[model samples]
Target: MSLRIRNLQSFLRPINRRFPQAVWSSRVVTSIRYNSSTPNNNSSRRPNSGEEGSNKKDTKDSDLPATNDEHNELLEKYNPDKSSRVGTPKGAIPAIDHDLASLLKKPKYEYNPENNTNEVTYEFPPPKSPKQLKVEKIREKSKPKSRFKKIAPSLIAAGLASWGIFTYSYLTSKTDPDKDGETGLLRPDKFLPYVISFKHQIDDDHYLIELTRKNRHKKLINNETLFNGKTMWSIEIKQPDINIVRNYTPLPLYVAGTDPVTKEPHLRLVSESEEQGKFIIIVKKYKQGEFSRWITGLNLLHPVEVRGPIVEHKFPGHPLDKFYIKRPQLANLLSKIKPDPEYPEKLPKPENYVYYGAGTGILPLLQLIYSPNPPKGFIEAYLSIHSESNLLDQFKTLNYFAEKIGRVKFHYFIGEKGEHLSSKDILKPTLPNFTGLSDIKLSEEQYREKLLAEKREEVKRQIANGGISNEGKKSITHEEEENHTIPKLDVSKFKPDNAFQQFNIFKKRKTTPDPSFAFVCGPEGYMADVSGKSDLNNLEMVDNGPIGGKLKEKGWTLQNIKRLQ
Candidate 1:
């Protein structure tokens, strides 16, 4: 009986436990909610009900937080040094532990939120002590210095190399040549030819020294035979005053303007020297020419080598440049003055005209007037001036011009100032045939009367105004314009009929038929004589000795004379 009762008890207990389980299962079904609806405790506990299964799993996972290795790792990473835990926003996670953030805090900096973005950021830190800051700054600066240090050795090496190259070039340039050192190019190691020198009175007003170089082959040294007639020598001038040196030393004289008829070489630049290894040089010793004095006083043998023959003018055409013209008259005149294909052209009909010359200043102007292509509407004219009587007598060329172009009216003043000629006497109508002469003689009585009368009239006028006191007499004399009609005092006397008989005198004058140019040389006086009186037009100044008078209106060029070993 006891065994049967025990069996019933066991059976009942099993049945009871099964009944609770069944009840719990039933309750879960009735209270269950779908995943699409709000979660509730009455959800089905069965695995088939997705909502209940997921909820149960979540609850279980929440309860086993200690067992989650991932949570432990997260907590380990978030643990900061000494800060409190901070609450995070819902659905957001904290990136760092509060303790770690405390370590980054500094004085003068507070975390503040940016108004626009609502983002928190740290403010600028406080400035450190000056000494500590300076130390840090120095370290920062040293970084750049370290970088440059690497290249310092290389820079030093490069500098040394460049210095070595310069030293080598300087040394090489000073060495002597192998041959003909006497006549070779001037160099440090070679000696220039020594020339004998002596001084002589050139005139009452001046003294100059003549130089003669050591024996050398003239043909080899002077390649151009232009100086066959004149001497190939140099002169050293000596004057005391520096002012005289400045006035007399014509260091550089250049040419300007084009040859009216021939568009030949047009410009020249010249320099003069009285030293060794040089060609002809013209040095003018004006009474007040300062540079002349300086040049003349130089010890010619004291290694005083001069440089010159610089060409100021060049051919208009070139590969690298377009010629630019400056003077308008020259441009216009040059365009019209084309070269004539024929050897000679018939002379134009003679027209009466008068000319005035002022000392030697009228030279270049005269050349232009006598030029074949003289400015349009030019007429035969008279010339007058004090005679250009000198030892050299370069003015003789004027006679040739007067002979060829029909005699120009001439009034000569020789020795002291003499008779003043009237324009009517010089500008008289002339025939096509005319002649020119260099010297003319008039009776002294007539010349003296004219001079005395002119002087008396001047004194009479001064006394009429109010007699000059002794002091006033020493001062400059002023003349009334009306009283001094002086009529541009005729420098030349004209015998138009006499000139007409001497026409066609230039039939034998040699001319440079080819494209040629001309240059004028000598003192200001000499230059003026040729410039104004010569047949060449557009007379330009040249730096060196002349090549030919035929190409007188062509360009003056600067040429260099080189001494080769």
Candidate 2:
């Protein structure tokens, strides 16, 4: 058996060489010895059993202990425990032991067999230090806050409040329709205070008052100069705990003369009683007008608040150009026509004007007539008064001054005391330039026959023109129908009578046709009658209130007729 064991050792020598660093222990060698000592059970299969036993013996021998030196060498070569050494190859990732990782993840438990209980325990991470906690807080605080989150609410609230305030103010504000929606609040800074320096009673109801402003306040009126009959100032008075305002065109208190230093003509304010800083206003008292009554009762040095040089009419250069050219449809038509050489490009000064005034209405007309360097025009004025004494002397004085600059003709309709002359009778014959009642009567009969003949000719022309067969002709006829359809005033209502006849006579008398502007300021009825019947086809009309409505109805454009009031 010893020999057999030696042979088996020899045969395993080659196998051991293949695994030179295989680990071995004393228990493994003992197991190999026991396996070699065991007997085979099979007798008939002796050879097969012997061979199998031998292979088992060899395998057991391979695990047997070698010499001490060889064992120590094997321990060094292939270590089972390498706790103190780096287990990874150089520049290579270390292999992870999943078993160790699972052991660490499992909870450790202490078994108490006596009580049949298990006490579970786990290790927790260490608590943070104060310094580490502070650092973490700082990192959190360093993050930027959202701007929308901080300010969005405040912005939304302010926007809503602003919109509400604007909406309320717009709804409550007072506006003027005639002034293209201008607010009623005039600039308070422009108001000037004056004192009534003098007052003279010209008649029972007519008074001439003089106002004076301090020399320091002269700058207030510096830019207050305006074109005659185009602008006026408002006088506001406070008395009897009531406010009254009236508008008046200030008269020239002084003659305009050339400035010696600048060579520019300067208007020197005239003071009738040698008073400095004086201006005059001719006011006619009315029975029911609070402002007029207050003015009549005003004592010397009474305080008055004045505002504006409010412009009623703005003079657009070249009247016909502005008047006709502003209408786009009309302008397009006019563009097709060749420009006329005789048509004046501009009238440096007006050529002709007709003025009609009664009582207080004459003040504006008088201002225009007496203006220094007045516009070059044939001015015809018709003045109607309660009595000859009321404005006869004033008229004479006006005529004397007016003749110096231009031709002026004045017709006075003076009535007996308590006998009020009808405005129609006063304005009718004068506007037509009839010298007496006989001329007016004769012209009326001829004017009726002439109007009838013109109507018949107009109908005949319409029929001859094929009525409305042509499309272009149809359009023209439609427009003509529209124009002719305008409501005409009753002949009795206007009493046109001889007005057109007088207009023809005036036109024939003039050497050449001149551009004209007509001004009528009197009773509403009188202005309506004169404006409706007057045949100054080339003239423009200006008045106050709706007195020009009749003219507007008779195909006169609102642009050609301005209502100041």
Per-residue lDDT of 562 in model 2: 35
Candidate 1 lDDT over 60-174, as tens digits, reads 6543323355346334334354453333223321243465345435344554544346644448645679999999999998775675788999999999999998788667655
Which residue pairs overlap in candidate 2's backbone? 253-270, 254-270
**Number of clashes found in candidate 2:** 2
Which portions of model 1 miss their true places by more than 4 Å?
Answer: 1-202, 206-222, 225-289, 294-304, 310-391, 394-415, 418-565
Worst lDDT 10-window in candidate 1: 225-234
Q: What tens digits encode model 2's per-residue C-alpha lDDT throughout 233-329?
A: 3333344357545677566553244447844223343322232334567788889977788778989888776655555455333333333322111
State model 1's lDDT.
Answer: 0.34
Root-mean-square deviation (CA) per prediction: 26.7, 21.0
